[model samples]
Target chain A: MSMHIMSAYDEELKYLTRRISEMGGLAEQMVAESVRALVNSDLALAQKVISDDTVLDDAERQIGEKAIVTIAKRQPVAADLREIMGSIRIASDLERVGDLGKNTAKRVIAVAGSGIPRKLARGLEHLAELALVQLKEVLDVYASRSPEKANSIRERDEEIDAIYTSLFRELLTYMMEDPRNITPCTHLLFCAKNIERIGDHATNIAETIYYMATGAQPEGERPKDDNTSTLGSVND
Target chain B: MNIMSEAAVEKALDQKMNTVPYKMIGKDVSVYYGEKRALFDVNLNIRENTVTALIGPSGCGKSTFLRTLNRMNDTIENCRVTGKITLDTDDIYDPTIDVVELRARVGMVFQKPNPFPKSIYDNVSYGPRIHGLARTKADFDEIVETSLQKAGLWNEVKDRLQEPGTGLSGGQQQRLCIARAVAVSPEVILMDEPCSALDPIATAKVEELIHELRTNFTIVIVTHSMQQAARVSQRTAMFHLGNLVEENDTDKMFTNPDDQRTQDYIMGRFG
Candidate 1:
């Protein structure tokens, strides 16, 4: 974050980074709160998570507009250009993270008061814990401008996806075991998917941070372990 | 400090092998003014019908390297340029070469819109008339029309061709200067921040003109604006502290320059 000879330009860029960091903070909070609500069946807290998403949405819009203005005014090039572009991209990903958290919260209301299986709830909580960790670490990478940390965060996504695949299989087994468990297990399955998607959005942020730090897109293919979509029927 | 062999550095820079014939070539070029060296061993190739941009911080020798192309530096007392500069295989600095003919073949536009005090028509016609490029009145008229049209200022000043060239707005005057340079049918055009004195809209128009003019003539532009270099040039050469730091494709140079000094300068971290 070297200052431009024009201090005003430096201030504008700093403001842009600050707005993105604020959005990241809010997205991470929503993800954590939504999962807490789901695990505890706190319907009011879930509703709170849903309503708080607008803050992230507003932050994203502001960042986008600010980035556009900064570009128009400063006409940044090279690393400065990358920094502004990275802010816009990271803001969008954080907004998606907020949406995913909101969707998870909505599912909490859908399955409220149903005597959920303790094991299924715990499985979802485990997935949320991992996703929340990824989200937090990726945010740290961006804040610190640490490409190495971003790379590690990107690599850890596969572990989250693997856990999600296992969760998907366990939920499918529960649904097949008892006809009564079908409704709750299906909702829990979606919750697990939402958490998995949160992991993905975190990985997207990691990739963006890497680009911002190095001025080049991360080389090679991203490690992917999400196999839930490819799973066939449990009868097989 | 990281040390690399010259060949290794050159390979890492990924200099593209130019296939087209060069309009101008400078080999082992150096410049000095009374013991103060301004450039050192700079080698560059100006491709035919392509826009090559020279960019660097102030006093980084970009303009000096540009002046060497057409030997503009020869005008300054004790400003000595040592090296070989060839235009279509003819030595530009040869003692026998006529500097006037060399300048007619290689025209230049400066930072400010310096139109002669004469009428617009006279400004565009001056070069052809002096160079004996037009034999008839019809030829003079035709050259004026075509140069103005190619400079994208034909319609704006056609009715006002009788008006003084300095009477036009800043942008129009700049365009008029460009038309004047084009009037002689120069093989190459050297623009040194031709749009610096213009407004944004005017700058855009001149930039568009530069893009169009490249089809008929080779162009070498020196600009302080990096975005302009990116937008207008196919090849970019970065100069730093009297050294040719890197020369490569414009996209590569801007996005991921191989030289750390180039990266630092583009990133605004260099002093």
Candidate 2:
């Protein structure tokens, strides 16, 4: 790409970062209210979060269009070119994250009358908070170009993993203790897993931001032989 | 060649130039062969920054139209023009316009490499020195280097800037011509069938240079090769019988043109 075009791509990257930050704020709110709706059985707030998904979808569409126009007009190349393009990929992930939050909120409405047991509800709330914190941290790293912040998010993702493992074992133990608890316990386990997946997606966004700022794919141990390795694992 | 034909040519010579975007504009633009109308009534405005390729069968005024931008036609005998062809927003055809000054602001790389009988450094520096565009010798050196860099010729000639430009291969020589053109910082650069005399490799080199230069200078190229015109020019203006039949974006004009005549010409159904 020409120098003029690369600078234009930089402008597009800044615009995309702003849009993502706005979407991040919305996603954070959705997660908070979604857990609250679960704890308090507030079907209205849960429904509102589900219905507001169209806002995130609209933001995704706008960011996608901006990236497409940047590609068409500026013809970015190398790493500078990749940043504008990476926004589209990251925006798609953010949109999916929104969908996942909406799905969790919809689950709240599913069990509106009979919410999950209080103990399982606490685990879900804890998982949601851990995921939200990691997501917020990853976003901060992305916006500030801080590798230290990104590394901290990567470490904090392990906290979500620990919560997921505890929630999984707790649900399994509950099912083993009383077969009557199987249905709700399984639903709660899936909800916690959903939150865990949100943390994973946040990590993916962090890695992408690292690539955008530093032009290096996040350094880690090379994975074992997998023919599709270059394609990267989805939502990670 | 007869009286009726002479009067028709005279009438064509009388029409005023229309300077409009997407059209090559020339005013009272005239060319002569001891009193003959190569182009008449040639008032035209070639649209801004488009690759307006001049294509027609030989001696059909396409090449003459391309040359008039740099006043390359001025070298010919009895070639008299009484109007203007402004590029972007500047009137280039005014009589008071210095041909040297005009040539600097509107550069030309000819059908052949035609590098001056000098080193590659001299070949590029010739324009800057003649125009006095550089303030110091270092400034002149930087211009030569940057121009060559922009032309994609720097790497090949960097080790041998002092070597005669004529010693380079055909493609290198043409790139040197391009470098020479860029050194003067022209807003528009005219190419007159630049690849005609080069081998396929050299032709490709010139075409690549044209693509690269498009970002900087509005290029108007004359090409006998129809495919070359289709490949290089964003907008193609096909001239026939001393008239611009169609001027459209390259893809559209090649695939589907407004005039049946242009469609025929592009498809090789007619010239």
Candidate 3:
């Protein structure tokens, strides 16, 4: 926890931490704004979310490049090496989270002018809220360097999965009840799936934080509850 | 702070069953130069057929520990050592043990290429000649050729076997020293910064040779370069201020060493 003798190395590591935080914050905002764009059918906000994803991609690329240069220059070992590698992995996951948010924003465009049912939007809003909380908490866990908080974050991913599975069922039932609902319902379904995947990316970040902080992967299976796979087809 | 689990997982996944056998064991090993203690109550083990790297900042007793393996410290006046260092079942420092024969079993290569001012062939055959391992001229020729081949220097030096070893390039001289050490067929080879005096290309060749040599001889290397330790050794031990801070698989030592001192030292955050 002391500064590196070559203070420049300490600065590079600090720069990595700061970049990851900035990237995490941007991803979180994109996911949240996309959900808000979906619920209110706000076209401009949805466009802004789509445009903002490129920034996350750029941040990821810059962080990855900087990490490689630092490795070449410092030949860092021990925790410094772990921190660099973790930043690369975490940046990758955050980039995917940004992409998922952009995917959700595209759905907002598909459902923008259409009259989406209030109940359907409500389910998606709840899913997005839960996923955002998970994303926010994992980023905070990474910043705090507390492996203990990472454990609870991973265990709670099952809760997000449970919600997503129920929402999947709900969306299917809505489609079946009215054939006219199929067109708009499919977009909402994709949006819900994207939000669910954002939750999964949050879990991935949590595991990475655990490894980065403690240098050991979290033990045991990661208690996944995404049972949508096991359910019989929509006919069932 | 255990970081071996990931490396262990990879090994388990690969289904590798490399049961490590200890080639040498040091227990309560302490070294003193008259009144100053250089090492304090160290307990460490060297794995058979593996490269064990000893690393620390200067004056941290890494070299002192390396010397204790073959009793190189005994040559220093008033230097006393009290502890058991066993090479197999024999205490290397015991009164009845022959230091000369022990050194042949545990040969060394120094930081600088210190080949004797003799023909390259004699420089390598010198150890075998002294030990009388070769009975005939043909036997000496075979031992010299094989030692050079094993040291990865034969291809460059085969045509000029009688030339003075000092005439070759720095890297070639270092490889010649390695060939000389290999000539004795030592069970354990001790290297004191074996690449410190060579260029990067030469250092790389020596590193590659060290990897190949692990099949035949257990090696203990004392080095100041953390990158070299990370690259060449299977197991790594960190010494700081006369104490062993952490020892672990090289994979873990470079990425996630246990003690704070080990991490700080490796990361150039030494206090």
Candidate 4:
């Protein structure tokens, strides 16, 4: 870690880091709670996760403002500038993760009365577990300034995408076999996609952490196992 | 037809004079005052028609390096400079080389606006008059007007040509000094904290002038303000503890310095 001679400037940067950490923790909890709500068919917890998203949004706004103010006042260069810019970028990615969690929670509410299949819900839980681990590891990378840990998390994104792809096919198979499973399985597909997108946000944060630590973008294309194009549902 | 090897082609390209040719080259340059060494062996290349900024903490040999360009350190008693500094192909430190002519080719501005106690027109015309650059009254008038215009002070002081240069505002006085430097049509302009005494608006004006001046002359500036260096310079060199730490493109130096000492200095980490 680097420090400025001005203790107040250092304190402000520390506060900014703390705020981002808080937002990361909140985003992680929301993803877990949203997935837990879906598995247990608990509407109350899903609603709570959706309502708590505003806290992460507020934290992101605070970080953005502080970073801009610090940039304007300190005119920081090199690592200090990178640290402030990295905080702003990480907060933005975390806010989007919160939104994805909130979207998953809303899907949980949509499928509350319809009984979800144990095998399908279990698959999604596993997917969420992978995504949460990615988020947690990337956050740890940010806090510790470890490009190696960040690279490991980035490499694991393909695993989350592979799980998401397999889960997509399983849900599609279930829907085709029984039209009765269509409504609930479609909702599950969307929730699974939300979790997949959370993994993507985690990967983005990992890339940002790598840049902050090394002052260069991670070389080469990020590994991707997402084969959603085969489903004919990937617009991109 | 003979085929050139890739290495030979690259070597030829490197030797070719491009837009970024070195105007001044310092090789193994070192400075000493009395028995104490103030600067280590420093090698730097100042590109033609580009602004190169030297930045560091107090007594870090940035100013000393700046002085070495025009041999301004010669005024100091018991000061010694070793190694070579060449302007284009000519050795500037050769005993036979006229210091007056050398100073005329490489003019300097100081931290404070030290305009001569003369009228604005006289301040601008002094160099040309001494060098016999103007043959007639009209010629002297033209040199004064052109120099003032280049320094971005013609419009501000056009009507008050006879007014004492010292009576102008701090920023205007600095511009007058710059106009004085330009009067000689120097190949390079060395500014040592030219805007340090000015207010923000004046600093901005001088910075703007520096940008405009780059199209016509090579500029080397020594400044305490990193932002100013970033704003006005294409290349930046960082000095530390009498050693040249690093030099690179201005944007690269500020955003991602290769040297930890440069990073520390620019980041305000104990500089």
Candidate 5:
């Protein structure tokens, strides 16, 4: 039947999209500032990032409720339904990423006064920066539906792996020189790797967005530089 | 390949298994019976090997959408449908399309127990005979047996193939109609409230029949019962006031919907 096609329904869909975008924005900011806190060694900023996570978590719950309502009410199909399912999955990944950022911030609090070498700290900061760039860029790709940007994000993940390798090696050097540095350097290593994993999670979100928009999984693996050896344990 | 590569290949295969055939595709479809519009710009792909349930309140277009699948609405004068509806990838409404051939590929069982006024075997074989779907008497007998078996009626009706179809109870009659629809060897079957006329026991039988039919034919069913929709369909499409309110995997749509309207309807706040 040719009904009037109510504006109320249109407004509701727009509201759902807006709410999800709002949640996504909050999650992105949490990851960025959490990394910034690590780099600047600002204990207060790290604490603030941890405290603000409940807001993002709560946003996930809100968006989840809205998504359920949309599915019940709209009966969307094809591209529309794809986008909604993608958004639900993305919300889940975003929430998990939020928790990971909180964990990183808590690690910052733990390793605050360990007097780690300046060079090791620099390596950690570099890793954080690479991952943060990947997160922001992948999210931008999702918002714009730019498969080119998504492809680039997939490509950019290699830089994060490189930074993690560099961080791993530097931390190993610290442990080799001073047996006392083992505990703190190990914690720092995990912190850097956690940030790298967050980048990977963001890449997963990018892949879903690409699928939702284009109806295909992105092609090809990102180039991995073979020259880089594994960061070997000194025992080996 | 290494175990990791083998695992990835297996994962891809598992994904491929998740995709079944698409039985029906409606593109920009709008249906109107004279001045009354029953559906508006409805676009959907009914998946194969799955039961798809259309649910809505009275006058909400669920039945209209279901009838459109088999072009059952074509019988009503002044009923115009704009846009394409394809069954098994062939546009069913194309001018060159033979209505009989189309009906043979896509058969429908109406809301009530509408068994033909003929012997059980005759009712089941009517379509196949008219369409010449069977090549011989033995072929017709085999078709009837398979259809009756598929409809879960062979055990009761096999000895009474000569008995009149209308002599059966309402539930048995509905199953007979289902058997008749299946007799033509259709690629897809459309059911309009196939259980509406039956008792609870009969409804359960027909529902079980629908579940079994999914293995061979894509089935689209319309029901007023939300619980039935949830029970039967892999995917559920809900309609409200001639618009597709929401469609999704049945579980997700019922437990979690992306629209408030869908939520309200499923929760029984309003249609």
Candidate 6:
């Protein structure tokens, strides 16, 4: 609630917070633009999303090094220690989110010449849209330091899983309907899986924020809804 | 508070309370130096074989409370302590109790190395000799050797037992003082900023020695260094403005202290 007595120490921690916010923005942009590239078949936009991922990587590295230096110099305790540790954990998760976005962008090139059917593109769009919302909301939760918002984000994680499970079945059906759909459908399945993983990373960040604010892990395991693992049949 | 974590913490505390016995208990302790009151109604318990740290800013009664443990305050002309302090159910402040014997059982090591100008052997042997802890020369010899060993200084000082204690490095002198305290075979060892005057390496050695000594003795340390308290003590008690703020396990106290005052004080947010 109060600033540390040393102004420079406060400045160091503020720098960490500002860097995390910037990295969050970059990650969100990558997810958004990669999905847009998929819908529009824009090779240039897909390339831009891939290139932007390195920036997130750099931000994560800087945050990690700064966190270590702050620990050595300040020997912070209580909330300060938790805040730094949370920053490291969240940075790492966001970096993985960046990789997922890049992987999805690479899939865009696979399906680009194959001319994805509008219906399949729309389904992938919906899945990406849900994951992006989660990413943005979890970042907002970090900015606001609200456990309520974090819990809400966690509860909504299953929505992405549900959409992904349906998309998995839909892609399978398209491949079965016609052999020509196999090449593009397989790539789309991977893209869908990548988007689903982004949702999982968003939940990871949410859990970190909850711990940062409350100094305690969220009780019980998150109610996982990714039923795709057991979906042996589309009917299931 | 998170409900699950709170439940775990409560359960852990319940188990600790049921299992760990108190080495000393002080109840409703208040101290006065002439007309000036230095301590309020403070109640604290020292757990057996555990290192308990007393921490606070200057003039906050941390040292005063440490002194009260061995009735060191009694040496001050106008100082008067009113409380029930017990060493295993024996009232320490009772009129019939011998202050000298009480001090022997609860030995003290001060901030400065206050070893006498005598040889190192003499310094370590002084307490045991006066307390009649050993009779034969061979017995005193073994006691001196083992005391230094317990203090983690025997390897360095065994060959030079007749050398003057003050001639050793600052850290060695402090360890010598600890060796002297150990010679009395005290039940509880009280250290008041014992490493403040030593270099970092020496300070680290003393800290390491404190950790090792915990298996045998109940120690209460008064320190200005929060890191030292966090490092060496199993439990830590924070004092502020002559009042007991809170005392808890060292891990809990440093990571997530309950009182805001303790948090601010540990984090250097207190003005």
Model 5 lDDT tens row, B1-271: 5456755975675555357667788988899999989899998889888899888778989888887887888899999999898877688888899988888888898888888899999999999999888888899999999999999999998888999999999999999999999988888888888888788999999999999899888889998877788888888998889988888777667655666676656655432
Off by over 4 Å in 1: A233-236, B1-20, B160-162, B260-270
Model 2 Cα lDDT, one tens digit per residue, B1-271: 5556654664554331123244335766666657677776565556556566888777778888878777777788777655567755567666677778877777888888899999899999988887778778899889989999998999988999999999999888989998998998988888888898899988887788888887777888989887898788877777776666666666556544667666545544422
| Runs in model 4 lying further than 4 Å from the true structure | A232-236, B1-19
Which pairs clash in the backbone of model 3? none
CAPRI level of candidate 1 = acceptable
Model 1 is docked with a DockQ of 0.36
Candidates 2 and 6 compared: the better one by lDDT is 6
Error of 1 at B162 (Å): 4.1
- Range of the 10 consecutive residues with the lowest summed lDDT in candidate 4 chain A: A227-236
TM-score of chain A of 1: 0.96
- List clash counts for every candidate, in order: 0, 20, 0, 0, 27, 0
Task: Please compute DockQ, using alpha carbons, for every candidate against the native two-chain complex.
Answer: 0.36, 0.01, 0.74, 0.53, 0.03, 0.57
Show where candidate 5 strays beyond 4 Å. A1-16, A72-76, A222-229, A233-236, B1-113, B116-150, B153-173, B179-271
Tell me each candidate's TM-score. Answer: 0.91, 0.48, 0.95, 0.95, 0.58, 0.95
The candidate, 2 or 5, that scores higher on TM-score is 5
Model 4 residue B232 distance off true place after TM-score fit, in angstroms: 0.9
Q: Candidate 1 has what TM-score?
A: 0.91
Q: Which CAPRI tier for candidate 3? A: medium
Please state the Cα-based DockQ of model 6 relative to the true two-chain complex: 0.57
Predicted complex 3: DockQ: 0.74
**Candidate 1 vs candidate 3: which has greater TM-score?**
3
Model 2 iRMS (Å) reads 17.5
Candidate 3 lDDT, A1-236, residue by residue in tens: 78888988888999999999999999999999998998899999999999999999999999999999999999887788889999999999999999999998988877887788788788888888999999999999998989999989999988888888898888778889999878888998888889999988988889998988889989888878787886656665
**Each candidate: RMSD to true structure?**
5.4, 20.4, 3.2, 4.4, 9.0, 3.0
**lDDT, model 6:** 0.92
Fraction of native Cα contacts reproduced by each candidate = 0.42, 0.00, 0.89, 0.76, 0.00, 0.61
Grade the docking of candidate 6: medium
TM-scores of chain A across candidates = 0.96, 0.85, 0.96, 0.96, 0.86, 0.96
Score candidate 1 by lDDT: 0.89
Off by over 4 Å in 6: A233-235, B1-18
